[model samples]
Target: MMASFSGVLMGNSTAPRHWPAWTIYLRTMGLFCLLWYAMSWLTPNKILLPSPLDVASALRDRIDDGELVANATVSLTRLLVSVSIASLIAIPLGLAMGTSRLLEDLLEWPVELLRPIAGIAWIPLALFMFGIGNGLPIFIMIYTAFFPLLLGTAAGVRNVDRRLISAARTMGIPKGTLMRHVIFPAALPSIMTSARLAVAASWTAVVAAELVGAPSGLGYAIEYYRSMLDTPSVMAFIIVIGTLGFLCDAALRSLSAALMPWANAEEKR
Candidate 1:
């Protein structure tokens, strides 16, 4: 089965050529819509699971009124801020830990100990520390994004070919220069993978945080409408969140493909 799938992906003799990723995505979405419609038809209570058309209508109304855009903007802002901070802090520390055994020894235990804790688990402390505001959501997002990026970056750096590092050093290149030129490029694919994961984590954290403590975000909107038994509105907000997350990941993948041609080629293979 795996071989057949790979043959399909590679357009080999054993299987027909696979559809483009976007085409497959569209087909999957269409199937999901059909299933959703069928389920909505079968169910007696629209409140429990509203029809897709009803949800779409609710989404359209929100979009026309600018409420959806406003809430999405707030959520995206928090995601951006938290991810930016996490990247800044994690990248350099990850580099240091990867390069220096002493630094790794110093930080590894603490990082490992803390990494197991879920970002959602920090909600209470974040609320207490930052209060019920943007700060709380941002903190939660940062907490969610930080560890994946840190671990991914450090692993990437560590996995860089020893021969390449030795060759650079043997050529009398400065340590900083070697790191900037050799280590960074070699580790970029792993870092990019981590960044994508971090983005996903940031989205999840922001929504979870907003659901509990925020005043203006998609998660908050969903929670508010849910309380009122506004199932269509809740579904609309959820659809918005899922769409935004998908777009963000797609954007990251496109950026990675543009910036890291080698990585893209490897993936195609």
Candidate 2:
């Protein structure tokens, strides 16, 4: 038994490679479509779980009519703006807090207190404050994105080697130069990872924020269709949301690889 267990452990040491990404995606999605079709057929009410073909047809109609593009663009634009704002604030604040014990002490409590709260929980209050427009969704998404980015940056900064900083200082490097040339580069991978998380979190928040607060967006389209018992269209918008999020993450990964050539580009794998 011991020998067999040891052999199994040794055998598993090398990770098996998967097929090319496109093939993997198609295979997975094909299975998913088959499962969806089966469920749709089994369901008594077809409207509740529309067949894959029905959803595809609806999706095509939306695409042809340009509603899909308009709403997807709106949602994507909000995600970009909110994430940009969150990154601007969080990165600098995280760097400062991570480096300075005093500053970290001052801000740590507030961060801890608020980070536990879900972004969707703020929608009710925000809806009242922002009153049904772009501001509400943007505000919620920024809040959602902020904590992940801030935490990621601080962690990256903290993980940077003290040895490197000391070596740079011993060589008479300026404080600003040491930070720019040593700390930031070392922390770039972690920061990029956090940026992706921030983007995802904000994207999720935008949907919820828009459901109650905005006149336009993917969330609004989903809700509008749901109200009208248009499950196929709802599913279409959902598929669009998921595809956009995946594409956005892929773009970020490419950017990370380009920026940090020495690091493993597919670290998550």
Please, what are the lDDT tens digits per residue for candidate 2 over residues 91-199? 9898887788899899889999999999999888987888999999999999999998998998999999999988999999997888789988988888999999998
lDDT minimum window of 10 residues, candidate 1: 9-18
What TM-score does candidate 1 reach?
0.91
In lDDT terms, how accurate is model 1?
Answer: 0.93
Question: 32-101, model 1: which lDDT tens digit per residue?
Answer: 9999999999999999999999999999999999999999999999998999999999988888888999
Clashes of each: 0, 0
Residue 194 of model 1 has an lDDT of: 98
Model 2 alpha-carbon drift over 4 Å, by segment: 1-21, 265-269
* Backbone clashes counted, model 1: 0
> What lDDT score goes with residue 38 in model 2?
99
